[model samples]
Target: MTDSRFSCVLFDLDGTLVDTAPDLTGALNHVLSQHNLAPFSVQKVRNTVGFGARITIERSFAHYGKTLSEDALDLAHAQFLAHYSENICKNSTLFPGVDTVLEDFKSNGIRMSVCTNKTENLSLDLLEQIGVSHYFSSICGSDTVPNKKPHPDHIFSAINRAGGITEESILIGDSMADVESARAAGIPVIVMRYGYTAIPSDELGADLVLDAFSQIPQALRDLSH
Candidate 1:
């Protein structure tokens, strides 16, 4: 195995680190059904997975020719969160090779953290439930910092919380927000091609595009140079 490119690696939580769509779809559908909207398929909802819960609920409503008032949206959002918190990991699973890749990074002395748009409490809960919380020294969520991703501070804060230096860190994620944030932070990004990104991964302008978790170490090495 080649030496890794980055001393620290930051990952995105939702579609990048885990397949969270099943439970998310359930949550979205739960809210939609409450509003008398048709339920969406897991596949249909998976397309919007990484965006966040409010947007997901909004999109689900769009499916049924309805729009919520801010008050209704807030109420629906609360209900979605409540239902989601109860079933957060019911059908979620780490992507193929994730555990193995993490173990390899650990053995290689690579510090890791999560920089996700999910709320801090939910992010932590999901990671704990899935038994991967220990792998990340820090897990910074959308609410963990003053601003969220596409904002460099979110990534910088995550790096800081992980005791990682920016010069030796890189982000591994799956969306345009991840790309832009890493760029603004002056770090290279490696995007997961299989993630739930609405656009093609290549268009995210990452330093390296990854087809699988196993490609990460090598991609890091290649990009670091």
Candidate 2:
């Protein structure tokens, strides 16, 4: 295999690499049902993802025209986390072509890592259950760094953990957080068209906006030139 132009490839976990909305929605609905609230469909929940479970829980509460006190919110978050951890991969699956793309990256000698807004332990659990944990040299989450995405420290932490340098790294993600984080870190970012975001991918102002997971390696090759 030939060496790749990029030494390190950083990915955002939830929307970029995996279609986790189904299981996320399942856990969310479980929490909502506990409070006797109506459940949101997976399609509806997709827009609420990317920020992490707490935010998703908060959004769900807001949707029901209710507000939670700090302590209540914390308890709800705990419930969501516990349930999600147990059912992490119940319906979660990698996006089409993810395994192939990851294999291509590995064969080309590129180091890879995951940087996500999900909690560290949960992220690890999900990745492990999804069967792609072996591909990432490092997998960092919201609790892994002092600051989460939109803050450069998260990206830096992931790169450092993966033994990667910023100058030779690039980010592939599907949200404003990813775009902003990569920009703050002074790295190129690619946004996937189909991801869990309210805003369109093209509107996120990424270096490249791709429509399919299969297009990533070629997109990176194009960026390298």
Candidate 3:
């Protein structure tokens, strides 16, 4: 893209920019093992992800045929957090072509930001560890705002932090939450096919759907034209 249709680009961290499933699944399974529950398959976790930590915890318990209580959920959630904090990037990797796409955006002078449901410190830590921290002008995690994805607060907050307004921004994400958030924020969104979404990508209601990150630059270019 020529970086004209949008002044800023907002990204969803987990499934969009990076494949963080390994760390997340590892942490969830670790917590399950502690309670004598069977580990969930990676595919199962992938299908259940894209929400926040609490929903992931609840889904984990439900997957194991266990009921989710507030106390148990809290404990399991903490375990996941603690475990992931130490091993966030153990096997995590950026999706194919992500670096190139990001670099293209940066080279084109498009402002970029991240809005994720992951905790602030964890998101920042992972971004820094993965060598993409310097690309974004602002990174807003769940804790950075009062609401999470599916809510416009994170997207709007990121736009504000990036010094852009809603009319001149776009959200790039891998789930329906991103679509909803962008819709609520009065911006357009593009969804990726390879991200962790609860349902099919076509049903997410994004302005565009891409199968590869490498296609993003061209897609944006087309949009600008």
Candidate 4:
């Protein structure tokens, strides 16, 4: 295996590391059902992700041409979370090549962390349920940091919490939020072409654009040069 260029690698949990849209869409549909609204398909819901559960709830509701009041949104958010937590891992799986890539990093003495917009406890629960929690030295979420992604603090906090230095750190993610955050934080970022995003992954302007997780080690090697 090729050596990694970074001392620390921070991954965005949902799209970058795991394919979580199935369960997330299931949770969203459960909430919509309670309100007698139409449910969204997994493909449609994929682009709505990356912000957080509350935003997901909002976007799903808007899809039905319904605007939710703050109180209604709060209720829907609570309902979505309850249903989601119960079935968080029912269909979630690590992306192809994730395990091998993680193993390579581990064996190479590179530190790793999960930096996600999901809530802290939920991110922890999902990571554990998906059986990859042990690979990460730190798992930071939107709620765990002072600010969420698109704000550099989310990246900084995740790296710092993992005892990683900014100079030797890199981010792997699938969204514009990740690009903006890493750029603002002054670090290189790699984006996955197969991840969930409203914008095209290649158009996201990352340092590297990968078609599969297996491409990561080679990409890291290229970046190091």
Candidate 5:
């Protein structure tokens, strides 16, 4: 638990900071209903969301007992974007204790940034809609770089934008993509236990795994010491 090296905290937007499952599920259900497919349960949607928009849509279609053709995929993708865009924050919210943890970091002079697999525009829109856009000094999304997470480019870009490097940063997320990306970038990672992760949180191989967002500040303190 060595945190002295971490001066900046980089977050993954969708599953890490924001509970975007509701809006995402709504959009998916909209598409499903249009195609005469059954809507999925929230738990099912939650389990399928961390992979990014295309994967989410693909999984949603699969769950509805349908395989999307290229044209159908494109149409569903468009509908999802439009639907989610309009309702991005209507049901989306920061995970519990997220604000307290973020404020604690800011109070301690730690810089913060967002590094997500979502498109830059949608990420910003969602962050702003959720009213936490001002907390981060940098926000890098999939479109911001040539490659997305598991590649480390987006994380590095965020670190750079935050005026730091991997040695002075940590990525807090709930997915294997975050863990692997931070590992590739040579940064420590803290994974939240209660987010939309693909596998068990411990299996992500993060430097630290926390059960709650409220525990983050203490976890960071432990790491720093």
Candidate 6:
């Protein structure tokens, strides 16, 4: 592969590009507290994340040894969304060296985009709040396409939205969802070991395992080769 093999870098939002677990778990705990349920720890919720808010809130309820009925789940989800939307990015921060790495990508003229399971408006709001929204040419959230991650459509759509061809794009992500989607879409993928992946990052079988954002340029080069 040559440098021309990749012209875009698609990223996973929550755990990969930013440490959103603080606000994400906080909102879940807020909803749980409303029902007099014990709150979930940030670490606990971090492990349950990557699947999206409905699932995160669902798992939080389960962690308290209680399951919600369909109607109850719906109501709880609404409450969680409301609270999360209001407090999005309150404590979230970009991972170490992300800004500098992104600047490097921009200087190299590599297009960048986001493909996340978070809903579109919420994802955009969070990115905007964190002041990195300008970095992504496209932000394809769960609702932005017909299907979400672990499905190839999400990856393809993100690349397309960024005006990059599939063969000329790679993904930097943190979960099996990212790996599976990237693989399915024939996109080379690099995983961040420090992000909120459910399984071991190495075990995810990404083209590269990046322990820090600082390793990104090298990993992208290796993947291109």
Task: Output the lDDT of residue 216, model 5.
Answer: 78
Candidate 3's displacement at residue 207, Å, is 1.0
Question: What's the TM for model 4?
Answer: 0.97
TM-scores of the models, in the given order?
0.95, 0.96, 0.96, 0.97, 0.93, 0.95
Error of 4 at 76 (Å): 0.5
Give the clash count for model 2: 0
Model 5, 1-225: lDDT tens per residue? 234557888999877899998888898899888988888776677778765788888887776677989988999899989998999889888999888878777777788999998888999999888888888988898888898898888788999998876777888998888888999988889998888865888888999999888887777778876
Question: Which has the better TM-score: candidate 2, or candidate 5?
Answer: 2
Kindly report which residue pairs in candidate 5 clash with one another: 2-223, 3-223, 3-224
What's the distance in Å from true for residue 98, model 6?
Answer: 0.5
Tell me which residue pairs clash in candidate 3.
1-220, 1-221
CA deviation > 4 Å runs, candidate 3: 1-3
Writing each residue's lDDT as its tens digit, candidate 4 over 1-225 gives: 555558999999989999999999999999999999888899987899988889888877877788999999999999999999999999999999999989888988888999999998999999888888998999999999889998999999999888898998999999998999999999999999999999989899999999999998888888988
Q: Candidate 3 or 6, higher TM-score?
A: 3
Report the number of the highest-lDDT candidate: 4
Candidate 1 residue-wise lDDT, 1-225, digit = tens: 466558889999888889998999888888888867778888787677666788778877876788889999999999999999999999999999999989888777788999998999999999999989989889999889998988999999999999999999999999888999999999988899988877889888998898999888778777766
lDDT of 3 by residue, 105-136 (tens): 88878899999999889999999999999999
Whole-model Cα lDDT per candidate? Answer: 0.88, 0.90, 0.88, 0.91, 0.84, 0.88
Candidates ranked by TM-score: 4, 2, 3, 1, 6, 5
List candidate 4 stretches off by more than 4 Å: 1-4
Candidate 1, residue 43: how far the Cα is off, in Å: 1.8
Global Cα RMSD, each model: 1.3, 1.3, 1.3, 1.1, 2.0, 1.7
